[model samples]
Target chain A: MLSGEGPIFLQLAQRVAEDIINGTYAEDAGIPSTHDFAIFYRMSPITSAKGITMLVDQGVLYKKRGIGMFVAPGAREHLLAERRAAFRQQHVAPLLHEAELLGIDRDELADMIKEKDPS
Target chain B: MTTAIDIRGVSRRFGRVTALDDVSIAMPEHSLVGLLGRNGAGKTTLMSIIAGQDRASEGRIAVLGHTPFEHGPTLRQIIYVRDNQRYPDDYRLHHVLRIAPAFAPNWDADVADELVDGLRIPAKTPLKKLSRGQLSSVAIVLGLASRAPVTLLDEPYLGLDVTARSLFHTILLREIAAQPRTIVLSTHLIEESASLLDRVVILDHGKVVVDDETEAARDSVVLLSGNTDAVDRVLSGRPVLESHTMGAMTSVTAAGAADDSLRALADELGVQVARATLQDLVSAHGAETPEPLELKKAIRV
Candidate 1:
């Protein structure tokens, strides 16, 4: 599961975030252990841990003493907020610029969205 | 930066075989250093001596301002993570984590927790039951999370796949950036890790063949490829490491210049000049020359 050309830890962090969004790991569920991830992915544990540590630093997961890591409370909300902000910066502005070039107004976009799903 | 490791005329030997021959080098603090060589080229021997796992037959080694051997406080500050870490049969993944903090002074619990969770290491699985890749991962976690001032990782990514190795490199850079420390990495996979290293220390046979800043080391050698006659003309009077020829085409590795004169000479001879890689430089050192008597004498002192 490779993505962009950045560090492996960032890719892993994205994958774990995806897993959280997709409900693969339910709210408050414990994440996999470092050794299992290493064996399953055939990666060095340190590399896998780099991803997990990223999530912890971002407050997406919290460690339980001597137990393991669990998805933090309100993690999905936090992720959604982050995604919304990222979407505005990475997609919305670019889309607006493209739309301006194509002469597609906000009303046209709204109509297109409505046509795709009336509900 | 202060010197984290200061090796002065250090030498190690096993009976008639000389592993290190009076090699002296100083490792600056908070930089990623690459220790490079072919198999049996005294790389591991030198690392072992600095880590205090093996004693040098001669010379002096100081890690963090103290002699490494049996110096508990100094030894604790240096973590040597290798492919062959010994664990008892009954030991499990949790066992190592449980005891790592005692030795690693700067050990970060949060980093350890994240790593354990990310790797998905089954806490209950015994060390013997884990696969080779898993074992390598365990070592990586300890090495990184330990946060020792002088972290020595010798081929820590041997069994890992490309993705895993990439992840390791990324984490290493980020961690080192966040908490600067003196790191010594010994690996045959030089090209992949080349960019991460601030400097390169190359050992040939039992001596320091090339020790220089990464940029300087890369710039010291020039590769010229063209017609055999043309390459030979340009290579004449220069120290040639190795050469290969196919049909009318020949490539020669030589130590000389990246100067305009050399570039113009290569152009005149229809030879293409390229910077030599660290791997090429190591290979060109001629597979470690036979240890000289002088080096042996220096080691004894």
Candidate 2:
């Protein structure tokens, strides 16, 4: 599941964020601990901790002190809002730029998007 | 942070050859540092000096707060597990594992038993009769169970396959999570164990070259490719480590990230940008080679 796009920890952090959005990790529910992640992924505890810490730092996960980390309240909504903006800027914007390079106008791009829709 | 192993200006010589030269690095408490390099690049010498197996010809070496070489208390707290661990002529796995507690005060027999069951190391098999993989597993068991305050694993997986190696990584993390300790693991498998390292210290020609957090090391170098002119124009002033070209395509591994303007230019020029993995960073520095002529200089004239 990890790619060489950057450090494994960052990739793992992004993967966990994706999981949260996909409803695999429900809001206010405890995710796996760092030790469990290390064993499951065959990664070091340090790496796993870095990934989980990233989520905690981003407010995607919250610590309950004596207990472990739980998905923060409104985590899914927060992540989805960020992901939607990211999709627009990263994917759709790039696609439009490429289309522009190929001499396709905004209308043509819109038409192409509509044609590709199954419904 | 408390320094677990403090090495300063250390150098080692064997006969007329210098194995390590003027090296200094401190490993903090409860860290997993990777010592990476090619074979015969003085990785063994540097680790041996830190483990107190060999004395440094110049400079000081300390484990915890005391010198390691020939020091009883300091040596006992450090476990040095080598890939080619030797045993007495007829020593069986059970006989060796039974005697492990004498050196390490923190030895855990239960952990040893658990590792034996997981790695499937035959307890009664004679050391000589064990296959290469099984022999390596014995070393792995000792390393995890010893629970030494300072543990140095010098490429402990020699004959292990992928499944066995994965077990080592999993078991190591599990044990480290239970009890925190300083670990300096030297390995030829750079990327394979990259994710396990807190920091990576790469050696070439008996010297520490790249020693940084696993994050910074990979991020410091950027890999770029496209037209030769475009690649050179974009990363002109940056330190180019590895460069290759075929026809019009040129690939260059350079230091530092490209700024916004540089990225825009690269995009305009069709230059593709990529990030370097830990392995790419290590391989870009190239390998180490000993000088035959300088061999005589290591000896006292």
Candidates' lDDT values, in order? 0.78, 0.83
Write candidate 2's Cα lDDT for B44-151 as tens digits: 888888888888999998789999988998988889877777898899988878799887899999988887887888877788999888888888888889999888
Residue range B1-301, candidate 1, lDDT tens digits: 6999999999898999898999999998876788988887888888888999999999999999999999999999988866778897699987898899988889888777766666656688898888777787787889889988899998877777676677677666656655767889988887777656667898888889788877678777888899866776777667676666566677767877668887888888788988787778877775423233233335555
Candidate topping lDDT: 2
Kindly list the per-residue Cα lDDT of model 1 for residues A1-119, writing each as its tens digit: 34243345566788788888878887899998754554444333445676788999999999999999899988988888889899999998988888999999999977876796666
Per-model TM-score versus the true fold:
0.68, 0.91
Q: How much of the true A–B contact set does each candidate keep? A: 0.00, 0.79
Which one wins on DockQ?
A: 2
Task: Give the runs in model 2 whose Cα sits over 4 Å from its true position.
Answer: A116-119, B287-301
lDDT of 2 by residue, A1-119 (tens): 36556677887888889999999999999999988887776566778898999999999999999899899999999999999989999999899889989999999878888896646
